[model samples]
Target: YYAEMTLVPVLNYLDIVGTVKRHLLGPRARNQVDMDFYFKGSAFYLADLYTGMSKVVFLCFWYASIIPAVYFLTAATLMVHYISYKFAILRSYRAGPKLGAELAIFGRVYIFPLAVFFLFMQADYNWSSFPFDNVCETNSTKVTDSYIGSHNLQYEYRDKDGGETNFLDNIKYPVEISEGDSYFKFCNQDMYNHSPKVFPAFPFFQDDESKWMSDDQAVFSWVFSILVIVVLTLVVNSILVRRLGASILSYFKASYKPQAITINQRFSEQSEISAYVPMKCDPSFLFPLLLCDISDIDTELIGWEDARNKYDSHNLSTDVIDEMKEDNEDAKCYCILKHFPPKKND
Candidate 1:
């Protein structure tokens, strides 16, 4: 999977699509093609390449616990992405789009947390289900040495005939087992012959009674991993949005640059007037957009009601007139804002 992702893109660098197209359409079609076809570089898209990189990176991290060598594959994938992208951009593709750290920011803010979580969960699962006869035994010195949480015992698989039992290595954590949850009352001579559920703690739960009796480690590993990932993801993204501030819209460089140039061009000739007679707050809070649909639940808890007002419930005709007037209005209110230069505009 990793090799294909890194190598297949090189085919684009060689323009296999073009070769197949030219050959399939016959030699006559090649002569009739556009004059710029041979001279112009193939139209390469950076966004697709970046997306593939993120996917393969996430894949590697997800499976690295099972196969440690996947880490090396991830490095190779990144190297190929960088080398092929830079080389193709220079030698074959047309000028790529001017951009900022948006894609880089996306991978950081979204993919890394998810990938890390999968890595942790897989590692935990491997330890929990380790097939070898491992862990502290009840009769061993390790059990008497530490806290109950630190000590665990696994069932022996050897039988009387000297045959191998090969039992699953499940840790037996010391916990209170009352008559209702006791192993002898629930377990039978043939407990292993049939399904584990026929034994006690049969509330049809995944574990016999609960995970402690069967596999205590499986359930907690993935759930806590998710919660940890959630907290970290929230903290990182919160920092991102907070730093962006109200100028988030300014990152729309394709739209922003032209407007900035036109505004500067128009205002260059006008010198002063204290920026016109009226400089008001624009009643920003009363705008329809600010009148968000807040639920009573939110109002009771968050106490945003002092600011929120219900839109007028006037007749349909009134709303129609309001909508028409809104559409007809040809004025824009400026907030004396400044525009920043787009990153790496070339």
Candidate 2:
């Protein structure tokens, strides 16, 4: 009910969006950035962080195959994060929503490791009747006396003679069978009457029936060892993948390096800087205008008094002139260009 009512609608919506996208851009083209549109302009930092942390917790718990506490916590955290993200998406960005094909690919990739973890859990069950201290479905119920010749009923047989006999080697019954000493010497009719004609095969060594390891023996120790190894493998693989991906991206000029900086001093000075620029000239060339020192002389503001014999004069046709410096202190250094049209040639 949960999947049909909730997930079906979501999948339908995605399908509809995908159909629309295919109509716009040909089906051959993949829309990788479509899903990003929802979070593009939103304040999704907290939601995104929590969502990723929830997945990490889930993966840890799944790989460990330990207690259920972490799984429950991760589930609750994921639910809260999903709700938080949905709220933010509804109220945040104004961009048109897009559904991306990468969503399905990412979902499958994330689930692949979990599937392996589950398969290992299944294998653990088949390994032994008592794989751990806690009893599982395989070992929940012990064999009853009603079923004779079963391995679980081994204690019922008495070992009479110290001699060993191979029953499968001969058609005649061994003499130890009537003596009631040989546990393996079961009556043909009784053996056929056992609930399961064939028993599950053991994967490990099958030296003697008494030599097998019970599920209760060192179960937690083995589980912990497996968990540690799996987690270590995952961490190492993640680090290698990150480094490899960065190296690959470097070829496309997409890789970045992080740098740290310290602010040694902080000061603020209010100032105004403005300039008249021709539209044809690029703005990049005008960057020096903002860096001009405030102490530089402005040729346009110089009057006759400021220019009076304090500066050497030079006649120039252009209204713009280069700044000049004076060696003497208290002597103003400035530039004055001859006005345009030379005062109408009067």
Candidate 3:
């Protein structure tokens, strides 16, 4: 059970990678196993998504009560990703973009936190079931001992037959119980006390279970930790995707520079124009194209020095800028406000 919980994700990931390679590289590479690229990509990603969802459901075996808010949120996230990828595959997504490399990347990155999440879930579920045994009897001299209490009793394992064995050197803490009629026998160590009254003590002697965390606390801690990881993953991925997409678009934009210049030259010949740089001009001049659906303010315009100058002259209150930043840390509003100081003329 322990090994399964630990190893299943790794195995699944390997399978997904193998499937992706086969799908992209063709049958000859994978021992004559032919598979469609779209089919393989969708299948593997959907499988991972299913496995993640199943892990959430698997937690129910340990916690049958009302599900934690985190559980619902996590499950919903997995579902959303599944639906999105499936929708893309069925409708809009093209396998030629990266030949299933994108799926493999997502599968590799997502499985890490997912694996950790399951580990926490399994550990939380089986926490109470951990092997523990209380000391039946002990005869050490001191009032408190390491295993039991300090008292004058020597401990030994007694068998069913009239034979006793003292293998104290071999045994470690948290002693393992042997099979058959094996029982612990404690003899009085103190010569003065001929008839010693041994006390039934605990295995690990310190009697404060209060120091341990309750199930609710453990659940919340685990859930909260997983939640933090999920949030960070989302935020970081969003930033990376945004930046990478921007770079790619920029490269493509550079590629069209010559064509744009040629079109502008033709337009200038037909009509009098001051600036013939179509790509560099304001978007309004370009056409009605929406790069971002955020208000009328183009996100690209935010990068323009002229627009930033205009914004600075507006003299928007610090409270307003602070409020925007407070609303969304990743909005980039804070960064724009920070870098573009308000015009002194205002």
Candidate 4:
């Protein structure tokens, strides 16, 4: 919406004006000085200025968009980890290993596709013919005459209206003459034989053919640059995510052991230790205990003594049963049948 409202209009205006100037007025306008020079110069100057300004604007847009995009992606990733730690630690803990392996495999697989997408977006695929060289010719003519007569006096030729005529038309020279006579000496003989000739040497000439031939190279360069940028961004982003995930996982692992230890200590002191001395049992073992009225246990024929014998006879600790009894002797003891220790052989 922002682009449509602000940027697109400006870009369209620039495109329209640029197309008109480049295609319509650029070729037809002659390089002649006149009262219109100021207007023409101002127009061209404004166009050049706008072209440079547009480039800066485009660059700013790219920078603005890319920086925020990268930052948002990074921030969102961190936020996800934070939320995982806060309310979803169990899932987060399990997800770390699986996500890490997937990222490693997918990062390698998608690198080339990312590069190609970038290249296609930035590349110009239009094909047109260009000129290599051009030749232009202009022609003019001059007339001269050959004469064998000797002139007594040199006189300037004039037209009937007394206008000066070119004297070279009246001049004459012998095609073949024997040398050694002063009277037949050459007088301005070399001047009549010379014709004005112009030979221009122009280097670095290119026409439509050259432009057409080079267009593909230009397009290839643009595509290649875009590909390079995309590949770099992808690889860098993948590395960053991989590192971030590892860091989060490490922090979770580092915090887990301490928390587990604290829970173990609390449970042990409250229920496992018969007295101050630690019992000969696995500190890590988990158990379930049941609570009921003493009447219910006697009615079911599963008395406290029976339950204790059922679990403790197999060498498993019945801490819950003892803890419940200590808390209330008259309170009945119910067994967590699912967690009951296996029967012992007599």
lDDT values for all models? 0.47, 0.38, 0.40, 0.35
The positional error of residue 302 in candidate 3, measured at the CA in angstroms, is: 50
Off by over 4 Å in 2: 1-54, 93-99, 109-346
Which prediction has more favorable TM-score, 1 or 3? Answer: 1
| Residue runs of model 1 more than 4 Å from their true location after superposition | 18-33, 125-346
Q: Write the per-residue lDDT of candidate 2 for residues 141-194, one digit (tens) a residue.
A: 443344434232112323467555434332343222222222322122221122
| Residue pairs in clash, model 2 | 130-215, 131-215, 160-181
> Which has the greatest lDDT?
1
TM-score computed on alpha carbons, candidate 4: 0.17
**Can you give the TM-score per candidate against the true fold?**
0.41, 0.24, 0.21, 0.17
**TM-score winner:** 1
| Residue 88 shift from truth in candidate 1, angstroms | 1.4
Global fold similarity of model 3 (TM-score): 0.21
Clash number for every model?
Answer: 1, 3, 14, 11
lDDT by residue (tens digit), candidate 4, 1-346: 2332344334433444444545567666575222222222112222332343333334333333224453344344344433433332232111121133554344444533443433333221211111212222112122123333344433356788978765645555434322332221112111112123211101112132222234454555455445556665666566666656666788767633343333433322343222221123221322222233222222223322333234344323333345635675332334232222224541
Global lDDT of model 1 = 0.47
Please, what are the lDDT tens digits per residue for candidate 3 over residues 138-241?
Answer: 33233322344323344477676968776545544543322332233333222122223211111122223322334564555455445545655665565566
